[model samples]
Target: RRPRRSAGPVSEAESGGSQGVGAPLGVMSALEKQLHLGRLPPRPPLPGGGGQSGSKMRMGPGRKRDFSPVLWSQYFESMEDVVVENETGKDTFRIYKSGLEGPVLLLLHGGGHSALSWAVFTSAIINRIQCRIVALDLRGHGETKVRNPEDLSAETMAKDVGNVVEALYGDLPPPIMLIGHSMGGAIAVHTAVANLVPSLLGLCMIDVVEGTAMDALNSMQNFLRSRPKTFKSLENAIEWSVKSGQIRNLESARVSMVGQVKQCEGAASPECPKAIVEGIIEEEEEDEEDEEGGGSVNKRKKEDDTETKKEHLYTWRIELAKTEKYWDGWFRGLSNLFLSCPTPKLLLLAGVDRLDKDLTIGQMQGKFQMQVLPQCGHAVHEDAPDKVAEAVATFLIRHRFTEPIGGFQCVFPAC
Candidate 1:
């Protein structure tokens, strides 16, 4: 099915109401004004990484560790940091890789999200199944700062995935399995069709359908547009996300925010003296720097100096407006195109109503293997992680992508 093109553009209300039933009236008036008018109010200056800074300071470890209570406690211990460069642009993006080795599972997150979106289930899958899991921060999102807005297109994103594949798995890599969520799913389809990953053995789409309704697209855009561009604290961001239905739970919301929000070096949350403490600690560390002499320590000192020079703000990591440009075109005729891909495909539908109404077995028959995860939402893995992992492990085993691990234990103790 192909998306129906609109002859004329629609207004904000027509696009979809920005205020949810629970949202206060006029809550988005300021954002709407900014949207219609020119440039948004100048965001406070923050330290600029510009994809070049690889300092551990670029991602505040103490700040990230602070959120462990609400999020996964052992997250930092599980994944290894990775950076991949697009051969064409030579642009490098950050990714977190689960070290388990077998076939490679490359993950692409939805628009406005980064590799951290997969955090909830990444380790679970790795522990349950024998395969390496690589999740990347897409262009214009997270640590990836894109030079060209044009590169955000589906076609370009597909090429970026290709570049990552080449960088991670050489000219002729091992069998590759792609699992993408929402916008990532669209990119995965395009990448598969583009023949970017010759070793691509399978594809999985999470919560996306070809010819996705325009209303759905509009609703998503409206929600993103209406959101406050900055939050005073990560907790504030988490509250907003939970209220807005972007995520269903506070724990997932906090972990997901690690990727979605960036703390400008100067902007400190009013609730805590955490930033003040960090500043004091940095000053003390600088005084003690001579004790540890090495090229690495010298490099760290340079990075610290760079970090100290710029003011930082708390703002979104994603370039929201630029990423929105591809929404309408992304879904058009994608379902059929991906269904026809030579590699086997799996469709994981999350919303119960959608599974009941749109994903009848007869319709799906011979098209691709489809599975429904009960109580899941658009953020399928976060909402129902254990279920998603179980389903994925089964799919991989069925495809012979990996061998079955007997007496598979649940990653989450509650599960």
Candidate 2:
């Protein structure tokens, strides 16, 4: 069904929240049937080399598709290294910023994804409305360096969000909207609950509903295992990410893939970016975090991933499998937290079925705006950035969070 268009909250019928709750397929519920958790990417074709034994990966658009990684500067105005001092120590968190004025859209990417993941969404949103973007590479993911990267507990990350905001603006900050996707969405809710961002005017969560997320957790490991372990080159990673449906948008994948992988130790290709290829030691030490979480240490797998990494030119920046222990924590009580947020709210999902009981009830009572964008994957912002941007821009404009830039208009009714 097409996404419902309105100036108000989504109706129950349109939300599809009335679907049967039981598992028609024994263990898989009707809701989980639509969930695409960690999509297992097929092995990418290595130039003349084959991908898998039965290679069927489709080629990208154009006669000659370029899979090269794009620089962050192509999308963001500037990148900052905010040094946040706390009881633990001084931690440097990397943030990418854009736009000159108006309210700030503080973006938090999902677990295992980087701030760069928001590159496409940032451009689309800015064009539709007057706003700024501050996309942070969370503690464990991307370029954010923290003393304790393994502490993905809700409390720690919520505190990190507060610390970064405080570090950026001492006491008074601009009117800010906490917009997050997947794990980031949960963090945004927790941040709101903690009253971390005093200037927070709105909250938007993309494609992360507690009910579906919890059910999908049981199959997360299978999804992780099915992914391609390594790429022969940087371009290989981007191509695989797109063709494998990991990220549907090509332009988004080009810029975002670089943040998800790093040059493989002892196997750096000539095409590997200089910055990534040179930080072998720092990255390796970062890997030590897996042990602390007990997710890859005495309590977790002992597989020889080191051998496999050596066989490739590039490998995943974070082995998400090790961080499995924190999965429940990321989403537990997320619904209540999101609903409890007093700020104006928006929930953007890839499918109407994603709406859980709590959120559906809240929407009926007009607690927040819910937009269902079907046909896209879980990475809703990346898959359909224009639609996501339009939905968000309209929500902001309706509430007068910020004035529209030239050539933009608000047609949707105010909530």
Identify the leading candidate in terms of TM-score.
Answer: 2
Q: Pick the candidate with the highest lDDT.
A: 2
Residue 103's lDDT within candidate 2 is: 94
Q: For model 2, name the residue pairs that clash.
A: none
Error of 2 at 160 (Å): 0.6
Candidate 1: pairs in clash: 46-311, 46-312, 264-312, 264-313, 265-312, 266-312
Which digits, one per residue and each the tens of the lDDT, describe model 1 over residues 1-415?
Answer: 2233333544566546554432222343555444533433543444544322222233543333122225433442344334454444557667777745688888999888878888777767777788877888888777765566446788888988897778776787888899999889989999999899999999988988864544477677676667775555566566566555677655667788777877755535442223321111232344356555544555774465456422443567765666566777677777766767888887788753453223344244666777777665588877777688888887788777886555674332121
Residue-level lDDT of model 2, residues 1-415, one tens digit each, is: 2232333444555545543432222233435544422233444566657653223344443234567899999889999999999775789999999999889999999987899999999988888788999999988888888888888887889889999999998899989999999999999998999999999999999999999999999999999977776665678788788767888888999999989988765645433332322111112223465545545442222242333344356777878888888889989888988989899999998988888999889988999898888889988899998888889999998898887776887667354
| Model 2 ranges off by over 4 Å | 1-62, 267-312, 413-415
Q: What CA RMSD would you report for each candidate?
A: 19.9, 17.0
For model 2, how many clashes? 0
Please give the lDDT score for candidate 1: 0.67
